[model samples]
Every structure is written in C-alpha cells, then in structure tokens.
Target: MNIIEDLRARDLINQMTDDEGLENHLNESRVTLYCGFDPTADSLHIGHLLPILMLKRFQEAGHRPIALVGGGTGLIGDPSGRNEERQLNEENVVQEWVKNIEDQLSRFIDFTDDQKGAKVVNNYDWLSKMSIIDLLRDVGKHFSVNYMLAKDSVESRIENGISYTEFTYMLLQSLDFLRLNQEEDVSLQIGGSDQWGNITAGLELIRRTSQEGEEVKAYGLTVPLITKADGSKFGKTAGGAIWLDEKKTSPYEFYQFWVNADDRDVVKFLKSFTFLPLEEIDELAKEVEERPEQRVAQRRLAEEMTKMVHGEEALNQAQRITHALFNGDIKELTKEEVEVGFKDVPTFELEESEKGLIDLLVEANISSSKRQAREDISNGAIYINDERQQDLKYFIDENDRIDDAFTIIRRGKKKYFLIKHV
Candidate 1:
C-alpha cells in the first residue's frame, strides 16, 4: 500500500489539507515532512508517541522525516490545547530537556546517512538569530492581528488573557516551517490534532512568503490526540507522567501501561503505535472479541511496543518479572529485578534489630497500626517470601532472606514490602 493508504488504514490521519494532492506529492518522489516537538519536559511521554510513530511510518514509506526540537518556541510556549499559561522554563533547563528528548527520539528513527533516514533539527538555530525588526518586517507582516486573534488558541484565552509572547507563538512556528521549506525543501508538517491551527498557519506562511505564483505548495497533517476510553488522560499513572527515560519510568511500568489499555482503545492504539500490517491488526481485533480472557492481543501489543521503545532485553525482563509476580513466585527475582519491578510499590526500611515479622509489617506501612499487624498475622493473612506466616511471634532473620540481603514481606494477599540488610 502507498504511504497515505497505509496511514488511512491505520487511522493515523486525523486531519490533513488536500489528501489527494498530498498523496500525489508522496507518490511522485521523496517528499520531505517535518514535525516539531517542544521541550516541555525532560523526556517525551506517551502523548508524543503518535507523531513519532507517524514520522517512522513516513520514513519507512520512503519519505524524509525531520524531527524538529522546539528549543526556540519552547521559550514561548504554544497555547494550543493548554488550559493555562505555561510556567516558563529557564534557557539552560530547556536546552537540557532538548538534548534529552533528542537522545530519546534517536532510538525510534534511523539517523544514519542512508536514504529516507530521519534527521534532527533545532529551530533555535534560525529563530534565535533573527532581530525583532527583521522578524516583524519579514514574517510577522504576513500574519495579521485579526487572523491571529480568530484562532481557537487565542480565542479560548481571551477572557482570562493571553500574553503577547504567546500570541506571537504561531508566527514563530510558521517561521520554522518557512525556514525548513526554503533550506530543506520540506513541504509537509505533521503534528497532533491540537496543533492543527499552528500547522495550517505554517502552510499559509509558506504560500504567502514565497515568490508570486510559486508552486511551492505545502501541506499539514495531524494525528488524533490519544485519550482513554474512560474519559481520562493517557500515559499518566498515580505516580505522574510515564517518562520515556528508563530512570524516570522503568521498563516494567512502561509495559504495564500498554497492558492496561482499555479494550476499546486497544485496536486504535495498535493501529497508531504499531507497525503491524493492517490485516494482522484486524485479525488481532477478531481474537480480542473471541477470547479476551487469553489477552493474546494485549500481550502482543505490549510486547511489540515495549520492545520498540525500551529494547529487547528490557522487554524480556519486564515479561519475566510480570509472570513471576503474577504467580507469586518471588524466588526467581534478582536484586535488579526487585528494584525495577516494585519501584512504584510503597517501601520502608527496618533495622536488623527490628526485624520481627509483626514489627516489620507495621513499620513498612503495610498495616496502619500494630494492632492490625498482629490481627493480620494471627489470621494467616501475612506472608514472607510468598509462604504463609501465621505465627505472630515469628521474627525475620537471615534464614528468611532471599539472597542473604533482603526479605519479601507480604501483608494480606496483595500488598508487598521489601526488608533489606543495611
């Protein structure tokens, strides 16, 4: 299938300008397309996954993909889809964030000199050098105040107030497109659905800024904003944003994120995020309907996506830990496994002298009070290393240790704790 047809089959094309013409451009030869990512956080979250996947799709389909880091535009945040003005970050902070994001992005796309390989660009190079007078005369003149105010970005914040810096965001973004179009001959800009206004603004800037009657046509495409079927935000846990960085979010946590995807969103997510053929996805959808209890589709989705982002070793480790935890077999777990597997689970340390089973349970915050700890122990509700510990007077010692350094404490059937030797 062609690039546009593949995108259409996967339902990745949310909105686009002139689909027929864009397809024509794609079929003719190497069409250069660009997508911009703001350094709003140290690492890109699942929200950024759609566009990155789309760019990968473009590259696989023999098109050049330019991943633009918004070092300049991040200084003045994009108001699109935001409820409030962004807390402006310092220059150094944004720069560091940009570097981190670039590193993370490299794992997803090929950056080598081969044909159709992706290349990273920073807008700060061009945007930072322009003078205020030159910006006003060259680019700002094409965009009128009336046109800018009519945009949903500016209109939504009218009552509360939008700053001039934010008001000028579109012009800056449009200038990025103009620069790319001129320097790299890029003709298409892709982004999330929220960026439709900004993408179109860039397309218009390209049309107006070029020579009269120039055929340098530009196009805009956006993918749908990912949302949970239950009306909650995607890629968020109680702990906070699921960062791409392994340190911030462990591979197991990232795998669980996809594993927990709602039934309604599974197929759509597979389409948008995975490179599995359309027929295969359709087959998986059928399997989901036939036997969701097996969760074959969900497992495959989690495996493929986690492998893509985190790598093969991480995926294997995540799967191994997942199976071991599900079976209540803690013996197979190693120290590194324990750290990443139970990273989010509440933890508390106990001194070797305070290693009594009841005291450890109470101190680990497993039970609210010592009375409850004793009650639970008496009722055979507590366990050590997955073995029932009914004796209230049982004291944790070196014998109960998993590797001569740690004890796995379980309160009731679900809550788990780790007691480590100092």
Candidate 2:
C-alpha cells in the first residue's frame, strides 16, 4: 500500500489539507516532507514518536523526510496547546537542546543514502540571520491582523492574554514553510493535532509569497492526539514522561510501560506506534481476544518499542530482569540489573559487615519488631537472596550478599527488599 493508505489504516491522518491532492503529489514523484520538533527539553519523549515514525514511513516509501529542529521557534515557544505563556529559555540552553533532539532524530531516520536520505535542519540558521526590519517588511506584511486573530491558537489565548512574542509565533513557523518550500523543494508539513493552526498558517504563507500565477505545492497533515482506553494521558506514568533517552528512563521501565498496556488499548497502540505488518497486528488482536491472560500483544508491543529505541542488548537486559523478578531468582541478576529491576523496592544499608538475621529484619523495618522477626524466621516467611532461612540464629554474612554488594530479602511470595552492603 501507499504511504497515505498505510497512514489511513493506522488512523493516523487526523487532518489533511487536501487529501486527494496530497496523495497524488506523493505518488507523482519523490516529494520532500518536513516535520518540525521544537526542543523544549534536553531529550525527546515517547509523545514525539508518532511524527518521527511518520517521517520514517515516508522515507521508506521512497521520499525525502526533513526533521526540522526549531532552534529559533523553541526559544519563543509555540503557544499551540498551552493555557499560559511558556518561559523563554536562554539561547545557549535552547541550542544545546536543539543538538540533543537532532542526535535523537538521527537514530530513527537513515541519512546515508545519497539519493533519498533524510535531512535534519535547524530553523535558527535562517531566522537568526534575518533582521527585525526585514522580518516585518518582507514576511510580516503578508499576514493580516484579522487572519492571525482568526486562528484557534491566537483566539483561544485572547481571554488569557497572549504576549506579542507568542502571538507572532505563527508567522515565524509560516516563514519556515516558505523558506523550505523555496529552497529545499519541501511540499508537505506534518505535526500533531495541536499543530494544525501552525501547519496551515505555513501553507498560507507559502501560497501568498509565491509568484502571482504560481501553483503552490505545500500541504499540511496532522496525526491524532493519542488517548488511552482508560482516559488517562498517554506517555505519562506516576514517575513522569517516558523519555527516549535511556538515562532519563531506563529500558526496563520503558519496556514495562508498553507491556502493561490495557487490553483495550494494546491493539490500537500496535497500529499507531509499531511498524508491524497489519496482518500480523490483526493476528495479535485475535490473540488478545482469545487469550487475554497471555498478554501476547502487550509483550510484542513492548519488545518492538524497547528494541527500536534502546537496541537489542537493552531489550534483552530488560527481559532478563523481568524474567528474574517474575521467578524470584534474584541471584541470577547482575548488580546493574538489580538496580534497574528493583529500583523502587525498599532498601536498607548495613553499616557493619555482618548482623544476626533476626536483628537485621527488625532494624531494616522488614519485620515490625524483634519478636515478629523471630516469628517470621520460624514460620519460614523470611528469605535472603531468594533462599528461605528459617534459622533464628542465622547471620547475614558475606555469602548472603549477591556480588558482595547487595542482599535481596523477601517477606513472602511477592514483597521484595534490597539490602546494601556498605
């Protein structure tokens, strides 16, 4: 199927300016498409994956994809979906973030192919060179106050009062489209649903600045806002956003995020976030229906996402940690794996080299008191490093420490605690 057809199947086409025309344009030749990512933070999160993957889809379909890092617009902030004005970041900070986002984008798109290789551009290059007088007389003159005010982005912020800096963001984005169209032969702009106003404004600028009889080829498309079946926000957990950077959010946590997808949302996530064939996804959906207990679809989603973002080794590490935890086999994991697997588990530090197991339990708060600690030991309810130690006189010696650094303690079948040997 064609790129548009595939996107349509995934329900990714939220809004397209001219459906038929854009489809024809894509089919006629190798069209160049651009998607702008404003670096608001040092790392791109899972929320940015849809558009990034869309660019990949186009590139794989024999088209050029330009990943635009808004080094300039990021400084001003796009007031697309915000109620309050964003704090303007320092130029140097924004530049650093721009570099980080560009590096992240490079991991997904193939830039080696000479003919249809992807490109990464920063709008700061051109926007930084243009003077204020040049911006007003040349680009600003084409947009009327009424046209700007009519936009949903500006209109929604009217009551809250938007600053002139933010109110002019649309013009800056439009200039990007016009500049890219004229220079790079870019014909399409894509973004999330919230960016519809900015994308359409860019198209308008391209058409207005063209020669009197010129036919503008620019078009705009946006992906739908992702929503969970349970009505909670996507790409968010109690800990925070699911960051693409492994340092920010470990591969294990990222894998867990997808592996725990709701039964209702798993199929939809497979369609939107994964490159799995439609036929394969359909089969997974059937698996979800027939054997909900197995969670086959969720596991596949987690594997695909974790491997794509972190790499095969990281995926394997995450799976290994998962398996070890599920089977209560703490001794099989390495020190690094223990840190990732039991990061949220309660922890206690041992100042001395050894201590009696009963006293250790009471001091670590594993048991309420010395009496309870003895009772827990006698009842075979206490385990050290997954081995049941019922001996009331047992001591936590060097042999009990895994890798001579940590000791895993369990109260029952599931509750786990970590003891650090310092």
Candidate 3:
C-alpha cells in the first residue's frame, strides 16, 4: 500500500492537507519530510512515540525523514497543547535537553547516507543566525497580528496572558519548514494533533514565500493525541512521566506501562506503534477478543515497544526481574541482576558497624519504627534474601551479605528494600 493508505489504515493520519496529491508526490521519488521535536524534557515520553513511529513509517516507505530538533524553539516553548503559558527553560538547560533528545531519536531512525535514510537537523543552526531586523522584514511581515491572534494556540491563552516571545513561535516554526523546504527539499511536516496550527502555518509560509508558480509543494500531517480509555493522558503514571531513557525510567516500569494498557486501547496502540503486518495484527485482535486474560497482544506490544526503545538485553533483564520478583525467587538473581532489578525500588545504605536488620528496615521506611520492624519479623512477614527471617535479634552482619556487599529485604508480599554496605 501507498504511504497515505498505510498511515490511514494504521490510524496514524489525524489531519493532513491534500491527501491524494501528497501521496502522488511521495510515490514519485524519495520525497523529503520532517517532524519537529522540542526538547521539553531530558527524555521523550510515550506521547512523543506517535510522530517518531510515523517518521519510521515514512522512511520505510522510501521517503526521506528529517528529525528536527528544536533547539531554538525549545527555549521559547510551544504553547500549542498547554492550557497556560509554559515555564521557559534556560538556554544551557535546553541545549542539554536537546542533546539528550537527539541521542534518543538516533536510536530509532537510520541516519546513514542511503537515499531514503533519515537525517537530523537543528533549527538553532539557522534560527540563531537571523538578526531581529532581518527576521521582521523577511518573515514576520508575511504573518499579520490579526492572523496570529486568531490561532487557537494564542486564543486559548488570552486570559492567562501569552508573551511576545511565544506569540512569535509560529513564525519561527514556519521558517524552519520554509528553510528545510528550500535546503533539503522537505515536502511534508508531521506532528501531534496539537501541532496542526503550527504545521499549517509552515505550509502557508512555504506557499507564500516560494517563487511564483514554482510548485514548491509541501504537506502537513498529524497523529491523534494519545489518551487513556478512561480519559486520562497517556505516558504518565502516578510516579511520573514514562521516559525513554533507562536511567529515567527502569525497563521493568516501562514494560509494565505497556503490559497495563487498557483492554480497550491495546488494539489501537498495536496498530499505531508496532510494525506488525495487518494480518498478524488482525489475528492478535481476534485473540484479544477471544481471550484477553491470556494477554498475548499486550505482551507482544510491551515486548516490541520496550525492545525498540531499550534494546534486547534490557528487555530480557526487565522480564527476568519481573518474573523473579513475582515468583519470590530473589535468591536466584545475581548481584548484577539484583542491581538492575531493584534499580527503581527504595534503597538504603548501612555501615556494617552501625546497623542491624531492625534499624535498617525502619530507616528504609519498610516499617514505621524499629518496634514495628521487630513485630513484622516475629510475624513471619519479613524475608531476607528470599529466606524467612523470623528472629528480631537476627542482625544482618558481614556473613549475611550476598556478594559481600548487599542485602535484600522484603516486607509483606509486594514491597522490597535493598541495603548496601558502606
């Protein structure tokens, strides 16, 4: 199938300009397209997955994809999706965020010199060089204040007050597309549905700024905003944002995020994110309907997505950790495995000379007090290194260490604690 057809079938195309014409243009040759990602955080959340996946689809379909890192725009913050003005980050902080985001994006798109391979560009390279006077005379004049104010991005923030810096955000974004169209021959811009206004503004800029009848055609496409079936936002848990970086989000937690996908949203998520062919997806859909308790589809989704972002080794470690934790087989795990497995769990450091099991448990917050810790130990609710430790006076001394440095403590059935020798 053609690119547009594939996108539509997968429900990736939320809004687009002239679908037929864009498809015809795309099928002709290796047409260049771009999607801009602003570094709002050090790592991308699952909400950013749709556009990145869309870019992957474009590259697979023989179109060149340019992943634009909005180093310049990130400092200003795009107000498209926010209810109020965003807190602007510092230049140095945004630059660091840009580097982190670029490194993460590189994992997904091929950046080789092949005809349709992806490329990365930073708008700061161009946007930073433009003088204020030149910017106003060359690009700012094309967009009137009335037109800018009418945009939903600005309109929604009227009561809260939008700044001039933010007000010019659309113009800066438009210039990125105009520049890419001129320099890289990029003809399409893709983003989340919230970016529809900014994407269209870029298209309009390209239309008006290009030479007369030059046929510098460009298109805009957006993916639907990911939301929970129960009407909550995606990519968020009670803990916080689900980051692509392993340091920011443990692989186990990331896997759990997908494994816990609502029964209603799993089918749509599979189509939107995974490259599994339609037939295989259809079969999985049937399996989901017939036996959701098996959770075959959910497992596949979690595995595919986790592997894509975190790599095979991390996925394996995550799965192993999950199984080990669930089965109460903590002793079976190696020191390295314990480290990776309990990376997200609460931890405490104890000097071998200073503390025993009771003091350690209370300090780690596993119990309210030393007396409570003693009571739990007597009640058989405490396990050390996967063995029941029922003695209150059983101090974790040097011999109790696994690998001579660490101790694992479990309270009840679900809570875990790690103690390290200083």
Candidate 4:
C-alpha cells in the first residue's frame, strides 16, 4: 500500500488538507516533509510518540524528513491545547530542553548522510534574526484579525484570554514552514490534530508568499488526538506525564505502563505505536478475542513499545520484574531495579535500633495499633519480604533486607509497603 493507505489503516490520519494530492505527489516524487516539536518540557512525553512515529514512517518510505525543533516558538508557547497562557521559560532552560528533545528525536528518525536521511532544524535560527518590520510587512499582511480569531486555537481562548505573544504563535510556526520550504525544500508539514489551525496557516503562508511567479505546492496533515477507550487521556498516569527520559520515568515504569493497558485499548495502541506489519497485528488482535485472559495482545503491545522506546534489555528487565511480582517472588529484583519498580510505593525508613516488626509497623503507620499489628501477624496477614511473618516477636535485622537496602511488606493481598533501612 501507499503511505496514505498505510497511515489510513493505522488510524493515523485525522485532518488532511488534501490526501489525494499529497498521495499523488508522494507517489511521483520523494517529497521533503517536516514535523515541528516544541520543547515545553525537558523531555517529550509518551503523547509525543505519534507524530515522531509519523515522521519515522515517512523516512522509512524513502522521504527526506526534517524534525523541526521549535527553539524559537517554544519561547512563546503554542496556544492550541491550552486554556490559559503558558508561562514562558527562561532561555537557558529552553535551550537545555531543546538539546534533550533533539536527542530523543534522534532515536526514532534516521539522521545518517543518506539522500533521504532525516534532518534537524531549529526555527530560532531565522525567527530570532527577523525584525518586527520583516514580520509585519511579510507575514502579518497575509493574516487578518477576523481570520485568526475564527481559528479554533484563538476562538477557544477568547473568553478565558490569550496574550499577544501566544496569539501570534501561528504566524511564527507559519514562518518555520515558509523558511523550511524555501531553504530545505520542505513542502509538507505534519502535526497533532490540535495543530490543525497552525498547520493550515503554514500552508496558506507558503502559498501567498511564493515569489516571482513561483508555484507553491505545500500540504498539511495532523494525526488524531489519541484517547483511550476508557474515555481518559492517553500517556498520563497518577504520577503525571510518562516521560521518554529514563531518569524522569524509568524504562521499567514505561514498560509497565503499556503492559497494564486495558484489553480494549491494547490493539489500537499497537497499531498506532508499533511498526509491526498489519498481518502480525491482526494475528495479535485475533488472540485478544480468543484468549484474552492470557493478555496476549497487551503483552505484545507492551513488549513492542517498550523495546521501541527503551531497548531490548529494558524490555527484558520489565518482563522479569512483572513475572517475579506475579509469582510473589519480588525478591528477585536487584537493588536498582527494585528502586525503579517500587519508587511510588509507600515507604518507611527504619532506624537501626527500631528493627522489631511490630513496632516498625506501628511507626510506619502500616497498622493502627499494636493490638492490630499483633492480630495481623497472628492471622498471617502481615508479610515481610513476601514471606508471611507469623511470629509476633519477629525482628527485622539487616539480614532480612534485600541488597541491604529494602524489605517489602504486604499487609494483605493487594496493599504493599516498603521498609528502607537507614
């Protein structure tokens, strides 16, 4: 199938100016395309995966893709998805974020010296150099107040409010497209569905600004807003955004996020995130219907995405921890792996003198009272390191610790706590 057909099958295409024309153009030539990523944070989250994957998809299809880092535009944040104006980051912070974001992008798109190799361009190169006269005389003339106000990005914020800096963000993005098309011969732009207004605005600027009878053949496409079948936003957890950086969010946590996907959303996520062939995904989908209790589809999706984002070793570590936790053998986790796996679990620090299990429970607030603690031990409802501690007199010494650092406690079947020896 053609690229458009492939994207259609994966449910990646949401809003396109003209898929037929773009498809024909792609069929006839190796068109140059670009997707802009704003470094609002130090790292891209899991939600940023779709468009990066979209760029990767095109690069694999022999198109030269440019990953535009919005070093300039990020200074004034995009008002597309925000209810309020974004507080601008210090230049130094945004510069650091730009480096981090570019490193993340390198993992997905090929940047080798091949003819169709991906390229990274920062809009700050041009946007910072342009004067207000250049901006008004060239770009501002093409955009009228009524037209800009009608766009969803501006219209949604009219009542709540929007600042002049953010209100003019679309023009800045349009400038990026125009600059890239002129300099890099980039003729197409891709982004998330929230970026539809800006993407089309870029297309308009490209058309109107063509110089000396030059014909402009630019296009825009935006991927769907990924929503879970459970009617919640994708890539978010109780802890917050699932970051691509291992330090911000561990590889194990990232893997577990996909592993725990609902059966309903697993197949859809596989199609959107993985480059797996449609046939293989279809087979996995069939397994979801036949033997869902095994969670075959969810396992496959988790493994594929984890490997894609983190690497094979990280995926293996995640699977090992998952199986160990399932079999009640969490003692198998290493010190660092344990830290990554249970970072969010409730934890209590144990003083050297306070090693007795009953007192520790009372102090850690794991038990309401000493009476409750004794009764819990007697009923075999208290566990030390996944081993039931029936002795009310049991004392947890350094010998009871895993790696001399941590000891897991289970109050019951589901509730878990960690004891850290200071």
Q: Quick one: best lDDT, which candidate?
A: 2
Model 1, residue 316: displacement in angstroms? 1.0
| TM-score against native, each model | 0.96, 0.96, 0.92, 0.97
- Candidate 1 collision pairs: none
Q: What tens-digit string does per-residue lDDT give for candidate 1 at 297-351?
A: 8888999999999999999999988987888787778878877777766766656
Question: Which digits, one per residue and each the tens of the lDDT, describe model 3 over residues 1-422?
Answer: 88888888988878889988888888887888999999988889888888998898888887789999999999888989788778889999988999999899988898887654688989988889999998899889899888888888988888989888898999999999999989888989999998899998898898888888787689998899877898977898988899998888888889989988988999899999999998898998998999999899999999999999999998998788778877877766777778877776788888765467788788889899988988999999999887889987777887667767678888888778898777
Backbone clash pairs in model 3 (N, Cα, C under 3 Å; residues 3+ apart or in different chains), count = 0
What Cα-based lDDT does every candidate model obtain?
Answer: 0.87, 0.93, 0.87, 0.90
**Candidate 2 has which clashing residue pairs, if any?**
none
Query: Global lDDT for candidate 2?
Result: 0.93
RMSD per model, one decimal: 1.7, 1.6, 2.4, 1.5
lDDT of 2 by residue, 1-422 (tens): 99999999999999999999999999999999999999899999999999999999999899999999999999998889889999999999999999999889988998765645678999999999999999899889988999999888899999999999999999899999989898889999999999999999899888888899988788999999999989889999999999999989999999999999999999999999999999999999999999999999999999999999999999999999988877767798899998898888999999889999998898999999999999999999998888899998899989887878899999988888999999
* Cα-based lDDT at residue 34, candidate 3: 94
